[model samples]
Target: MKLKKVVLAVSMLVAIAGGTAQAQAQPVKNIVLVHGAFVGGAGWRAVYDRLTHDGYNVTLVQEPLTSFAQDVAATRRVLDRQNGPVILVGHSYGGAIISEVGNDNKVAGLVYIAAHVPENGETEADNGKKIPNSAHPFVKSSDGYLSIAPEYYHADFAADLPAAQADFEAHAQMPTNAAVFTANIPHPAWKTRPSWYMVAKADKIISPDLERLYAKRAHSHTVEIAGASHSVYQSHPDEVARLIEQAAQHALP
Candidate 1:
């Protein structure tokens, strides 16, 4: 009976040690994902799954595509929930939201996925105006909201995805307030935090050149995915997740 008790105690100690080690191995920082206009947090499933599988706590921010202020507030609400440091990620127009909220003390770094890394006082529309070859001019608006035309989905927005999926995404696209693009960002987080940027070479919604320009100004660690469309987040989840992991490592919790 004494021998049995000794063995059981040893087993319990081993299990406790293993659990502690596993917890320590997990990433210290959490990740908050923000989706751009015309879509919601559902679009971040692939990246979210990948990050969560890797043992990093991840939250997807479904910012109301109403106005920029509301989007920023939604992002902050998620940031406030994190226990330690956070890695804020934005895709497309979602990048703008992260830029506004990344200034929070909880955020350790910023990750832009085929997204706009706008400067303080600059509006999304301002970037659109300078990028003449961009697809912004082709966007349609009604009742103060803007959307991408279905045809552009296969041709430019999400060229990497299957045509059928693109068709569905275009049909279900989120309508964002058209005025949000022209609204100025007062505190651009990229200015203060370390940032990483990924650009889709064939992106149509925003010009590839403009992406590079934003990356350069922000001095972000930048990567370019050739032939990728604006929807590279969906087309290239692994690469996107990899970049976020790198940011988490570089950031201090």
Candidate 2:
């Protein structure tokens, strides 16, 4: 009877120790993902699933795309909800939002996914002008807003994706005011914060050369993937998720 009790006690102790170790190993902070212009938070669904499945807390921001200030405000609202330090991630135009909002005290790191990494006082329009083939059909100006034309959804923005998925995304693309693209970022978070960049070599919407230039200027740790379109998070979700996971690890204390 005494031997049985001893074994039971030992088992319980071992279980307790294992539980403690697991808790310690797990990262407590959340990751905030911001999607760029023409798409809503829904675009990050695949990445959100992957991060959550791997035991990471994640939030995807639905930017208003009305103006740069509005987008940054939206991202900041999401950041305020996180309990601890956060990894701020942006895709495409979302990167510009992160650049402005990522300087918050709560932001531990920044990740740019086929996204812009602009310097202070730089606007997306300025960068786009530098690239010859950066124009998209959906990208148009109405009144004062910038929007993507529905027809160029599959061919320009996401040529590598399936027709149905591309169509769905194009239809779901968010509209950004021209003011957002024209507004220059006042303070770029990449100036002080650690950053990671992913370059989509096959990107047709944004010139691959421009992406490289931004990555180089930011001095960001970069990962290049070939054959991936601008919507890399959807077409190569696992890879994008893994990079995000790595960024989270880098951000952890």
Candidate 3:
């Protein structure tokens, strides 16, 4: 009887371990966020909280924004850690990074939030000229690094944010290599992967028209937020989170 009991206990342990492995191998409920230049992962704080509250494993990529190739490498490094399928998200210039990052096998879908959705052989700067909005005056480049003028952070960039907070973000901006914007993309992931886009209608930074054009070109499901500026992710975290959930749940089969 003792021998029989020990065998049953061993069998139970093996079953539990197998079950755990199977659970881990299931499709990932993971979401990886990539931030644009001039901002760190801190910008995703609200969105991160919302997704986490819903029981998602969330990872934020603090892309160095030093160079285009390096940014793509950084994003891929995070994707490498995911065990199952991943929903990749990008905000602002982060869209460009995702266009390349989504090519990874682990990626299920992509979400773009007021981001620069570029195509193969095209650079963000080149696309910018196609639309030719007046926001370029707000951008200042020094020593090959690009940064937005703090003066526009309130009126043009983050109109949805509180003045005090926007002020800090403006001054604490991360300067990206100007060449990164001019750097041509070799492969745009959106060409092959499913995508969703959120356009900040009131965005003076990237222009809503351009956002629409990019979304249309990529064949992305799109939502335009009225009166939202470039900081739409922070101002409307719920909407952004909902869209990401759609991609993770319904979109990623």
- Models 1 onward score TM values of 0.86, 0.86, 0.87
Q: After superposition, how far is residue 97 of candidate 2 from its true place, in Å?
A: 0.4
lDDT of 2 by residue, 137-199 (tens): 445664766666667778778888899988887777777787777767777989888888899
Task: Name the best candidate (by lDDT).
Answer: 3
Could you give the candidate ranking by TM-score, starting with the highest? Answer: 3, 1, 2
- The better candidate by lDDT, 1 or 3, is 3
Per-residue accuracy of model 1 over 139-195 as CA lDDT, tens digit each? 656677887778776776777899898899989888889877877777788888999
Identify the runs in model 3 with alpha carbons over 4 angstroms from their true place: 1-28, 136-142
Q: Give the per-residue lDDT digits (tens) of candidate 3, residues 138-219.
A: 4656577878788876777788899999999999989888877876677888888889999999888787899999999999
Worst 10 residues of 3 by lDDT: 133-142
